[model samples]
Target: MTLLTKLKKSNINRSEYLFLENKLAFLTTEVVENKYRNSKLVIGLLGFVSIGLVLVVLWMQRKRKGLPIVGLSRQERNIQGLILQGKSNKEIANELFISISTVKTHITNIYSKLHVSGREELLQKLQN
Candidate 1:
């Protein structure tokens, strides 16, 4: 017999060859499954990133509009500006040369229009 034929016969074993075939099949299947799972993970990460970007865009749009950003009349705007300077009712009255009671009324009106509870909250609302 030829050297190549003799070598092939010496190397061949039916049971060992079948076992190796089964092992290779299992390895191939595992590689394919891992690739599929990796692709799914990549898709999932991209989905989350897209959703996060959309939310950020919406939030930025809202921020650009400012806090509530509703239009204000001249008087309300002036009162709100004065209140932001830590002005008490009497202090605002002295500054505006109005009655203390009128200043209190203006403060109440400002709180109502701003939908806030107190002066500190009002100032915070204006700032951010």
Candidate 2:
């Protein structure tokens, strides 16, 4: 047994034993200045959990909306991509083998879904 263990086993007064317990705690914690190691681990764990929770929330939100906006459908996204490349609607229609009227209809739908007034607004929305 250790010396401290032996002292504890002795019939010392209860008050002295209590004082010794306090001294040991202080020595191993406050005096040594190493108690923060456990606290740091706890803080790091909490940070990781917080980040994970935030990512999960973001993922669920994204899943709830297949696309961020109603206008950003597959066809609209493709058409917009071509438009941003400076392709005219007719050229886009020819490239996609869609009719000119089909292209115009898609354009109108895209504008309505995007809540845009015209091509300028579409460009602005894409820029941001």
Candidate 3:
């Protein structure tokens, strides 16, 4: 039988079917739109996180590169330079306007960092 004849036999009117069909279409469209919006939001968040992670990695790499290039602080490096210039610890202390004990501490720290035992070893290491 034709669809309208079947509908009539089932006691469902054409207007009712049309109304239900329109409602279903509107609901389906709303569901599809919501899914698209949700997916777009997820993708945007992922993109934002990815960019943030990349920037963080780059910043860490830059900081790491700057650190190992000179493991000594400004004062320690200056102390080493003065020592290399053949200045005695007392002379270095006098020139740098620090105490002799502080000069000794800087020397100890330099030796530990450079893996040297004394001024001779430090000079040898510097030459190499």
Best candidate (score: lDDT): 3
Candidate 3 lDDT tens digits, 1-128: 85544655676677997776677779989999999999999999999999999999999987764332357889999999999999999999999999999999999998877767799988887876
Q: Which is better, 1 or 2, measured by TM-score?
A: 2
List TM-score per model, in order.
Answer: 0.44, 0.45, 0.49
lDDT tens string, model 1, 1-128? 95434544777687766676677779989999999999999999999999999999999987765454365666667767787777777777888788888777777777776677898888788778
What's the lDDT for candidate 2?
0.81
Q: Which ranges of candidate 3 are over 4 A from the true structure? A: 1-10, 69-128
C-alpha root-mean-square deviation, each candidate: 10.0, 8.3, 8.9
Candidates' C-alpha lDDT: 0.76, 0.81, 0.85
Off by over 4 Å in 2: 1-71
Pairs with steric clashes in candidate 3: none
Q: What is candidate 2's lDDT per residue for 54-73, written digit by digit as tens?
A: 99999998775543365367
Best by TM-score: 3
Candidate 2's error at 118, in angstroms? Answer: 1.0
